[model samples]
Target: MDALIATVKDNDLVVAFALVGLVMGVAILISKFLTRGKFQASAIAIILGLVLAYVGGVATGGEDGLADISLFSGIGLMGGGMLINLAIVATGFGASFDEMKKSGLGGIIALVLGVVLSFVIGAVIAWFFGYRDPIDLTTIGAGTATYIVGPVTGAALGAGSGVIALSVGAGLVKSVLTMVVTPFVAKYIGLNNPRSAIVFGGLLGTTSGVTAGLAATDKRLVPYGAMTSTFYTGLGLLMAPSVLFFAVKALVG
Candidate 1:
């Protein structure tokens, strides 16, 4: 009982858990109102809930306090949250890809290839400039690739687990890069319609989700992505460091 109290007090797990529950409830309410029983929002709500949990958990120092937790266990929780969120969003918006048919697959493939190529190119440049840490270079490369190619490509390169620090660092870098490049790519691709914008936002969110899942030592990306707004770039920036801090702490502890 004393240990339980200490855990609660040190980590603020209660508050974090409560916040997550609240966010999930809100998501359900929103989905019900918007979809009117035709579409389920549970996946989206779950995602959002996890995001809230992570943000709240970090704010309360759960990562530092939960030092006893295994890296894989934490990552599992995080990744589960992210997958739930993705499933929800994908169910709602992935239909757009079907509409585009040939173009959709082509676009996804192109984006992936672009990201990989860009990372290779960026790594060479970083090396030429005398960057020593391969992990750091990889992070920089992944971020640059994501900006030039898209989220899929960026995530593929960024998800390397070579070093926990570099992987987390890459996540932050990718978020910044996504913010800078998403708008441009959307505009260039003629994604000006409101529907297109919504889908694009979901795609970007998914990219973040996948990267966080693969890179996070604790696997908390699912929850983080779910709680985050699909359209808000600032939210991504705010959450990236929180995720990274927790991840690094988990590694250190």
Candidate 2:
């Protein structure tokens, strides 16, 4: 356990980034091929990530015994896993692609608003907690916020606490919040069109793709959902680190 923790501490950034890229690549490929293009890249990435983590743990002979894999870890590995599920469900039952195309601008506006809303919500919560220190709150808030908006927010929160616990916690919190809020917000704001469904479906498909592989299921719907989720998850991952960087800057400034 100690040795594994040391290794992780020593190579945290490298390992995390490598895992992120590798997982995203693998998930995308798997969904593209195995699911006959029904799945998403993000889903394949997550499953591959879990496999890598488990393999790494085994190779290192870590005494933690898969302690690296948890709900929080899942969030890091499969950022929008749950949201993919929601997106998939919404797509399955909501608007069609034609409708989405007609409301293209509206959809874009809604997505932007959703992300902004998430950030505001996160900042408000952090402030309410009396978290006055920019450095500390930025880290915590970023971690917590990423789930809502993606890694950008999570990274922001991660600055304060370098510990995996804080990072994973923030990620998990963000994921849960996004899963619960994004869809409702989108619907309420009238972004529930076919284009939105297709977008959401793709995201869900990505998550579903990897989930299907992990669960040993070969259903097309699984991949469909996974792919849908993967798209958004990847977007989140790309944005998370940057958001964290800027978050710190805002606090300092």
Candidate 3:
């Protein structure tokens, strides 16, 4: 038993992949049987992974979550920025250039409105919480656009770690809410077709949230949604530190 455990630990990367696959398989089965696929297996897998990571952190009393354990060290790499960027690029590859073109001005409008609205809401919340600094306000506001945008803005503007963490937390909350609420609200929001999906994705710029939400609502819409959400993220990253920061400074400082 000890020797087997050691061997698995030594091959942790492969084992991590196998474990993730198994978890995803189970998530899919449960979603199919119980929710009739309304809940989305990918979202379930994400929640499950978070739970496991929390448990790992609590059990080991370490900050790195599951990756702090010897047997699960591979998870750190699997979830790192390199693999994350690769996955984002791969998702982009799934989008059809022709369909994106069909989205036209509506898609572009959605991206602008979405980023602006989300930032406004986030900035208001920061103000309510007594965040007076322009950098902190802009960083958190950008984070609401997407988690990726939050840290990038923070780093570019030299925001403190505490403010950056709050920005990330805000984005994380938005993502989880989007994932859980998408399917239930899909019909009411008229989110059935490709054009609507693109608009919705821009409004909710988190890649995982938009894609997973679309996956739950309609698997066919994922690519369309992902494309606009990707652009929204990039736009947030660009705007937050420059225009957004200056506006906040002028308004509040």
Candidate 4:
């Protein structure tokens, strides 16, 4: 047993990959058998991950969640910003300029509208919650664009940890909602083509949610949606900390 434990610990990253794969596999099965594919596997896996993280935190009283248990320590690195950014870049690699041209002006409009709407919504929510500071408002607003943007904006603007956490929560809620709701409304919203998928993804601007939602709606649309969503993330990262931050500060001041 000691030898096996040491072996597992030595190859913790491989174990973490296996663990994530297992969770995804199970989530896929649940999505197929239980939900009949109404809910996406990625969405289910996210919910399961959150539950496990909460449990791990409560049991260990540690900040790193499941990673604090040692056996799953590699999850910390595997889920870190480096790997996340790499995945985003990898997703972008699959995009084709020809396909992107099909989206054109509609895609650009969606991207701009998505960012502005999410920022306004997040800022309003932050204000309603008694956070009057520009940094807090901007951080949370950027989070509504995506969880990644939230932390990046907060760090760049020197926002508090609590505000960052709130921003992450707000983004998570938007992601989950996007994932859960897209399929139901896809047909009604005319989300039936590559151009529409691109626009939809740009509007939502949550890569995981947009990808998973589009997957549920139509697997063929995933690449198109993911492509624009990737650009949306990049644009958000560029605008949130600088342009949006300054705008909020000016308004608040």
Tell me the whole-model lDDT of each prediction, alpha carbons only: 0.42, 0.45, 0.85, 0.85
| Residue 93 displacement in candidate 3 (angstroms) | 7.1
Q: What is the lDDT of residue 108 in candidate 1?
A: 47
Off by over 4 Å in 1: 1-86, 89-97, 132-164, 176-189, 193-206, 209-253
Candidate 2: regions farther than 4 A off: 1-96, 148-158, 162-164, 174-252
Candidate 3: minimum summed lDDT over ten consecutive residues — where?
Answer: 87-96
Tens digit per residue, CA lDDT, model 3, 63-162:
6778888888988888776886686567566567787798867889999999989999999999999988888999999888888789889999899999
Error of 1 at 158 (Å): 16
- Scanning candidate 2 in windows of ten residues, the lowest lDDT window is 214-223
* TM-score (C-alpha, index-matched) for candidate 1: 0.38
Expressed as tens digits, the lDDT of each residue in 139-221 for candidate 4 is 99999999889998899989999999988888888887887778778889999888999899889999878876876677777
Better of 2 and 3 by TM-score: 3
lDDT tens digits by residue: candidate 1, 2-119: 8865665555544455545666677678768876744334444544534544554565665422222322233334335565466645544423443444344433444344444445
Question: Residue-pair clashes per candidate, as listed?
Answer: 14, 44, 0, 0
Q: Which runs in model 3 stand beyond 4 Å of their true positions?
A: 32-43, 60-65, 76-96
**What lDDT is obtained when candidate 2 is compared to the true structure?**
0.45
Q: Which candidate gets the maximum TM-score versus the true structure?
A: 3
Q: Residue 21 error for model 3, in Å?
A: 3.0
Candidate 1, residue 185: how far the Cα is off, in Å: 9.1
Worst 10 residues of 1 by lDDT: 214-223
